[model samples]
Target: MDGKVIFIGGGPGDPELLTLKAYNVIKKADVIIYAGSLVNRDVLNCAKNDSIIKNSASMNLDEILDLMEKSVKNGKLVARVHTGDPAIYGAIGEQIEGLKEKKISFEIIPGVSSFFAAAAALETELTLPEVSQTVIITRPEGRTPKPSAEAISKLAKHQATMCIFLGVQMIEDVVNDLLTHYKPETPAAVVQKASWPDEKIVKGTLNNISNKVHEAGITKTAMIVVGDVLDTEGITPSKLYDKEFTHEYRKGQLN
Candidate 1:
């Protein structure tokens, strides 16, 4: 098709986090479909004043796709804006499939995901040597039931740093299931609306994080991070920066 559509990741509630490509696309878009409830409204300001903007929060997949199809058929540039990286639970698969069926050309411009923003806000790394060399990103089973193998109870057994998304409403159940594999004192934290102006963070252990989150009243729009990396009291420095470690870029001091 001659008409094109662009899927832009708006990042996690921070207009400044938007990529240059996404910003430019929004500015040039003839039609913009934004996830209003989750994306920061400030990013919408980038769109041309005459652009046709619609909130997809209340719109179903068919409705949204219809809008895009109509706009594209009229030879207009349609921009589908999603919060955070669209690849991560952005539900763009169905939309892409629909676009393909209609033979519409499209491009995806990725943005910063909430998990990375949460990590930045907490000043914590997901992977730490000798602590947690792996990071797992998943969510608790809800209306969308995950495979039994991907269940929290089973994933927790790895003891890797985990970033739980869209599970704040089920924080208690999440913590309880995590306790099955993590120690009571394993450092855990919850970041609400990361990168937003009024963002909130609750830090505690497996035994107390639920209460803390409950007291904070963060029912949604939060990310749960669990691992020893949160306990940044005395982590070993990475070998990459170690003077004694050798690499192609530098000689080992020990040698």
Candidate 2:
């Protein structure tokens, strides 16, 4: 009689960005479980009146699994909420594997990542045709092992716009690795506590990014972005905005 478990992405810290589907599921969930340290608590308002809300921050893996098992065995709808997109370093793999061993059906719901929201908060585009055409989302290896191919230094060679998560504490290392390929003057920005009312942004270059980050005393809950995409100073007009350029969305008319 156990019901399904739905893992929902809480989408940065802004409650407004949660998808309609995610909201609907939360509203109907009989058991709402969320990552308390990262997710905004205001999101709990969407849950059903009788729903049992639990914060998983204080619980260990076994404890969390036990809660889920009990909920499902009671034929209750469970919503497992995570901050940002659940797929990225959300630590859901181990949990999902455990669920499989217990024969519990589950579904993952995706949400906008913090990197996208950080870029949006700055009103900047990560990909520019010539300036930079690629976006790399990565993190500096901490306790987790990063593949050699995806190492920060190697990925820097492309000079693609880079968004690094869970690596703010190692900003010095990040700056040094990026310098292996990118110029010292390559524009970079750090968004701290992005999308939240107290969000702060520190903009600089590869040379000074680490220093600026340190100056701000921001050690976590921040995203480090690098490349010309953050270069608001030397912006060239986009072809889409050029009147002489024609496109299906806005064709050029005879002058």
**Candidate 2: tens digits of C-alpha lDDT, residues 85-188:** 99987999999999999998899999878998999988898887678878999999899898999999999999899999988899999888889999999988
Alpha carbon lDDT of each predicted model: 0.93, 0.89
Best model number under TM-score: 1
Worst 10 residues of 2 by lDDT: 229-238
Measured against the true structure, the TM-scores of the candidates, in listed sequence, are 0.98, 0.92
Question: Which segments of model 1 are wrong by more than 4 Å?
Answer: none
Q: Give the per-residue lDDT digits (tens) of candidate 1, residues 155-202.
A: 999999999999999998999889899999999999999999999999
Give the CA lDDT, 0 to 100, for residue 245 in model 1: 88
